[model samples]
Target: MTQKLAGRTAVVVGGGQTPGATVGNGRAAALTYAREGADVLVVDRDLDSAEETAELIRKEGGTSLAHRADITVEADCESIAGAALDTYGRIDILHNNVGIVPAGRTEDLAAETWRRGFEINLTGMWLTCKAVLPHMRHRGSGTIVNISSMAGLLAGGETIAYNTSKAAVHSLTRSLAIEYAPHGVRVNCIAPGMMDTPMGVDANARAGGVSRDDVAAQRAAMVPMRRQGSGWDVARAALFLASDESAFITGVVLAVDGGFSLRAGIQ
Candidate 1:
């Protein structure tokens, strides 16, 4: 079968992770795109982690480049875009897979904590879009996939900052999609549901001071499917959005959650 993304160049911000026992969405997306024949640029604040992802792609006989990028900084965002262009000469997809889960109640949340969440979860995404828009505009075509969370839609209480930040991403995706549609650029968002990813397990452990296995069990129970999703589930959703398969689709918030949002009430 022919690869859906052959000849395309993709930049996945935050596409660096060793899984910590489970693969992260960013890393999964990078690998998926690479397997589908896109030259991928893996960007993350951790040079080592980013290189690890890049190396995996190369080992699979796929094209990839890795760069350390602190997305919270405007200059770093600029450099990420520059690095991708320098390495691949063109940009067909921009996957903003970076996010932070700041666990805290709104009533008692620290002001600094909320601000930090916004910086990495929201502002960083905006800066990246800004940095890459000119290039996409020049090419007159692009696809941007922002990774949000099911918490944004289902209101998984207590994590006020994270929920709000991801909710804002959904709005950003819609507004940008409309603005860029005429330019042939599609902007979309993905909301991943309860998954067995490292951060997912870690978040549960942090909240209850329990072991990852215990948290994983709890997460599985909460899902109607009676199973936790995986980074690969989210990756495939992203793949569809970033490829020509969704050519007519834009400004969509595709939820990769396992019916978590569909079940009414708090999760």
Candidate 2:
């Protein structure tokens, strides 16, 4: 079933390569949006990785442009949104996927580390939304999908900073949704569980303090589905939020976890 996001334009932040996966969430979402007929703006801190994603989209006969900008920087966020508007003439969807999961407890995390987490995960989203709001308001319609994590909903034992930052994103999504709904703009968030993406693998490895496969197995064991999710899993969820199919859905925190969020502590 093709999601008809045709003729619309989408901007996916953090579209770059992680440790294990060839493509990250931003890359997957960009390709999916393009496949569905939306022009894509693939943004990442690494220009090379973003270009790679854009090249794949172009090879697939889809329109995509790569933009390198550090979302943690307010100026970069403004420039990115401005560039998208200048190139595309409008911004219909903004997919905020910037996040970093440094493994540590609150005591173990340095103040700088904690601040960095907020800078990239929560503040970046806010900056991007601020930069794009005027253009979206002028158009009188827009959709914003912020990528949170199950860690946002539940306590993440090791990554306190990451958890807190994501939780902020969830709240931010709701606030933006309510405030902008009257303007025909919708905002929502997807909180995904353990996904087997590059970032997931790296996070697992760090948390486990072991080989990548060991981390993967540990993650799979925790999930009821007996496996981790893929980038495409979250990509599909983003597509739903970006498309008109979810025209009435706003301020929703859709968990893309495969029953992991539902499982009780095993006996």
Candidate 3:
């Protein structure tokens, strides 16, 4: 009901909503962290969108700042982390929510598109972690929550590039967890299933070749809950990882799907 991450500083990469009613996972996670008493840093490629999320947090009486950076680039990642450290003095949580799902099969996808998917979805997390881990390790405590997807755990048809990138993130999470556990840094990942976010809708629109509503319905039907998940579902799980509530948890890929990962088939 109240602050679980008080006095913590959280950085949420890709915290920006696209042009629509739906908020992105990063935006929701940033707000949730703020509401739980963490000073939030909302990072995105688009300055305006990141600022919009930061404004929302400020409006809710939470401390927040916005930083625009291309997460795919090492220099940008370093600058963003530097700014956060300058502003907040320390970092307690790093949430990697940057991802892009380009629609393509292995052969049909252009080399550039495939590279871009890996650049943002996989390499971006690596860069952010690289930039933040030193500071975290120096402080002797931190939590890193990387947002992977169900596509990583299971096959995502026709989106080989995106799927592979997410799978790589899962591997990265495990590697970091094992290496950093002795230093008191917890590394984990969230593999969200089909969620009702703008990015999810865009991914469905591009890959499924149908209206967003139809895609939503089809995804809901695949879930045992008879409904799709919301951004808050992932956000809440992230909060647990970011807070001390999950102190013993590390190297875990928590699936925030609506029982979709559990069932064999609807039958």
Candidate 4:
């Protein structure tokens, strides 16, 4: 273990995943942080899945704890932060990996569906950061990684609220970074594109009633790299942002896409 994060405590929101075909970015990041020597706090709405991630870390000789949290709820976010402090005594890295990807046209999508998209994708991230910022400020130094999406940077014909909300996340990250830099806290965002994770592949497959393989090929062709990204790809990008390697970096939106955003290119 390189121990890039030795003696640190990481709070990974949405860190529980039972990917059917591919690993989720949240789980991959949790495992990566633990492997790199940070005690991890795996927080997910799914208690069983969160426990699974925590147990895996313990089995690998890494320190970890799991908690169930509904980040969209302000009180739950508060509890999540408290849990991390109570267990680890201090917080060093906060990974906001919780989000949803419900796609629909604005006019066709139910109003509630549109609102729920923003609630989970944008509001949840904000609330969690709000809960963690106080602790990070008190510590005098900390890192926060917000996961956005390429869809945020460049949306297709129809995205309803998912794309709009993620775009908001980018703005939120920049503002937080600038505001907190004076407090010795750094904030950045990772905009992932078309990962082969369960959310990207398996979920799409089921939703479209198409074969997983078919959806995978279609997504791969859309990527300029000719291959879809994996959860590990996003995890690696996050590791850099979370670790001291990016000590001088803040308020940057680092893309984890395989040239997909470039193909879309500042549109």
Candidate 2 lands at a TM-score of 0.94
Instruction: Indicate the worst ten consecutive residues by lDDT in candidate 1.
Output: 258-267
Cα misplacement distance, residue 157 of candidate 4 (Å): 3.1
Arrange candidates by TM-score, descending.
4, 1, 3, 2
Per residue, candidate 1 scores C-alpha lDDT tens digits across 68-91 of 989999999999889988889999
TM-score each candidate: 0.96, 0.94, 0.95, 0.97
lDDT per model vs. reference: 0.90, 0.87, 0.90, 0.92
- Output the number of the lDDT-best candidate: 4
Candidate 2 per-residue lDDT over residues 1-267, each given as its tens digit: 384888888998887676573356777898999999988898989999889889999999988899999877889999988889888888999998888876688778889988888888898889999998888988999999999999887777688888888889989999999999999999999999988887888756765588888877888999999998888999999999899899999999998888887894411
Winner of 2 and 4 under TM-score: 4
lDDT of 3 by residue, 165-230 (tens): 898999999999999999999999999987999888756576567888887788889888999898
Across residues 93-147, which tens digit of lDDT does each residue of candidate 4 receive? 9999988877778678888888898899988999999999999998799999999
Off by over 4 Å in 4: none
Which residues of candidate 1, in runs, are more than 4 Å off? 206-208, 265-267
Report the candidate with higher TM-score, 2 versus 3. 3
